[model samples]
Target: MCIAVFLWQAHPLYPLFLLRNRDEYPSRPTEPVAWWDNGEILGGRDGLAGGTWLACSRSGKIAFVTNVAEVGKVPEPKSRGDLPVRFLESKKNPTEFAEEVVMEAHQYNGFNLILVDLSSKSMIYVTNRPKDEKALVSEVPPGIHVLSTASLDTPWPKAVRLRTNFEKFLEKHGSGELPAEEMADKLMTDATKADKTMLPGIYSVEFEHSLSSIFVEANTDQGRYGTRSISAVSVKTSGEVAFYEKYLEEESWIEHTASYVMEQTGTG
Candidate 1:
């Protein structure tokens, strides 16, 4: 599972500041954060699916997704990872794209997707889950929030921990440029697991507990699996954006940063 905490339209200098942890089997082939071959998108790619869990476009659009934690569900026909890619490549605004997604939400597995268009100052949260209910599409209110394997800010143990710590960090930094690397090391790397009773119970307590931490490291029959990378993205009001990632490759850890100024579309 993956987890992320974001401060949106709540900071003075940076309108959107986010930190994400990508957890998967270590053996899975993946490409670290970089500009895609098309040169318009930036983020890590799932080598097997050719899609990303999180990515941003040159035009100031950003999208990311997290899988819903559940059991006994058959796989869907489409890949959830494609959701983010489709949003980034679309000309439609966040609400429009989310509306489109709702039409085909049944084609994919359970997922929570966040779509953002800095130009429009719009951020929409879309989820196709609870199987019995219709897909949900709604605009995200401005504030600090968390998204994990459940609904947006569901108050899961890890989500609460991340939000609390992130609030403290913001208070201490006080409008200054955030230290992305330092924050990643101190906050994202936390391995604290929740108590058995605290688990969401969608899966077995043992399995869910294994993924309870902000950073996950679990060994199962599938082999070694856990958080393989941590990403920090900060978008400044000045149009500058910084994308940073610390990822694991061949048993070694590496880091990279990509910075660029967003294209100024007067509407933003």
Candidate 2:
């Protein structure tokens, strides 16, 4: 996912509210949110890598991955998508799992991963970006946070706007049982409401228009690039989970919805 804003324990009624936008070439193949045959995990699948950028286990575990934007970084053999899938498959607490991943983080391209354990109301964020001070397991503080094709909370224009808008969304709609459609609209915006002078620094000239907006669409010589999918997830304290997704197919966004009750397998 390119841009994501997750509210952990920020709402009184909902413990988790996650909104993310995955950007890629329009031709890239992907499947909308759905449970695998085993019916334990739920999220859209990356057809090319057979992994997922974001997913939630029935036990209230959540994982999210985002690429680090930089130049001349060597690509790793392991796909970043595997990070989320692997976390969902493991039973380790977020701290243990994040620390273990840091040991082998060099094996993958630069990435930022968020692992959450709802049973214990804990979250861990880890990244392998050389620019960061050092790799370590850090707890995700309560309240609003943003992640994009950069370090976590990097304050990229889109990230800042989304975070601000998300807070306003919650404040206007109230913290209780949020309107998923309104939440989805908060992410569907194409407005690039940022200072023009800061554009070149935030994004390359070619990708400025595309990457500046919360919802992107930049057609350049490189390829037809834009936001491919928008997903909104709300997990209630009572274990009622609601997931809504819209995938850009051709020229329109096809919508899909799913509801699952989180089964407390065990405490993290």
Candidate 3:
């Protein structure tokens, strides 16, 4: 369980969309996304053996999450990574996907995800706000969006801060051409800040800011990890879409891209 990226908006062709980063220990169980030897779509597996999680489908459908709440009293559900490969590989509609998961919340632990369908152009946020609030979701708007605890377009304090900082770059460039690798130094500013989430000492890893430079771009992948530049947002004019991405060393970032199955496809 690590980080997630999503957006809800009113747009043409596609609306609801998600790009998540599922970070975890290298030994936690997971799998990679392979376009079957015969070209059959098997998608990928999350936690198959320290597997990493990230995904989106050809249908523009996508989903991902981090452990917001662990359901210990309820048999601890299966795993969030396991969901995308299932959802991505299938051609289910956005509403059906959301409803299906809503009915089976107990099967997984605390997590948040945005499911979008390029065909129908629908977006929904499936989130269990810890034990304090009930699971909730809603529609998103057009244009690039950044989400963490809420549908916020800004940074929060901890690990997500790095993502938030990237948003600032989005506004600065007014486009996605601002080389991420070059801006790795900016992450040092975010890491040096206070740790609001208190998850771990990820903030202290500022020395690795150079790596952040490489995989700063975000998008959907099957089952991967780390900062992925999956589909670079190029050709940002009207009636155009583009992106590029790559996974991490422990093999987490790599799996995230291949996770997307049926629901994900090339952007318009």
Candidate 4:
């Protein structure tokens, strides 16, 4: 599971400021944030699926995904991680790409995919969860929003916590350059668990409580499972983008940063 809080077109200095926590088993092989061999995309890579949970293109496209917290999962469903990679690789805008996903949405387990194009100031949220209803595709408004294991901005305990803290930080920083590393340390590393009454009922109370924190850590029979990486992406109005990640590697935490300027589309 993953959770991300992003401010889209809400800040004057930054068109998009996003922070994400990728939660998974500690043993999973992962590559930290870096430019791909193609010299375009920038983000971490999932070693098992060769896909990414959050990534952006040099062309100013950004995408990230999170799993839905449902119990009755489809057996051997298509890999949801591929959603972000495909969107980044495609020429389609947010709406077009999301529409395509809706067609085969059922083939994958429940997911919440967010597609963003900084050049066009477009952000789309797509989800194929709550299987009883149609897959949802909607444009995300300009504001601070959290995408958790549930739908976007569903007010899960952690989501609300992140949003509230993030708002205070933004207000304090006051439109200047945000401290990406400091923000990650203060906001993404929080281990406060939600009260039992606030835990989502999709999973067992204990299991859901374990994941209630913004930074999740739990001991499971399979091994240690928790947030493996924290990523912060800040894109300035001048086209400069900074991507930073603090990730666990070989039982130690390492940090990396990649900086680039978005290619001007000249349309926006």
> How accurate locally, in lDDT, is each candidate?
0.90, 0.81, 0.44, 0.89
Instruction: Write the residue-wise lDDT of candidate 1 on 29-96 in tens digits.
Output: 89999999899999999999988999998899999999988774546568888999998988899999
Reference-based TM-score of each model: 0.96, 0.92, 0.60, 0.96
Q: What are the clash counts of all predictions, listed in order?
A: 1, 0, 58, 0
For model 4, residues 112-197, the per-residue Cα lDDT tens digits are 99999988999999998743474489899999999999888988899999999999999998978889899999999999999999
Compute the lDDT of residue 61 as modeled in candidate 4. Answer: 96
Candidate 2 residues lying further than 4 Å off, grouped into runs, are 130-134, 200-203, 265-268
Q: How many clashing residue pairs, candidate 1?
A: 1
**Using lDDT as the measure, what is the rank order of every candidate, best first?**
1, 4, 2, 3
Candidate 1 is scored at a TM of: 0.96
Model 4, position 168, has a per-residue lDDT of 95
TM-score of 2: 0.92
Residue 234 in candidate 4, Cα distance off native in Å: 0.4
Better of 3 and 4 by lDDT: 4
In model 1, which regions exceed 4 Å deviation?
A: 130-135, 265-268
Candidate 4 has a TM-score of: 0.96
Model 3 lDDT tens row, 140-256: 566656543332333334346655655666557652345433343343222243433333333334422322322232222332233322322222113233323343445343412
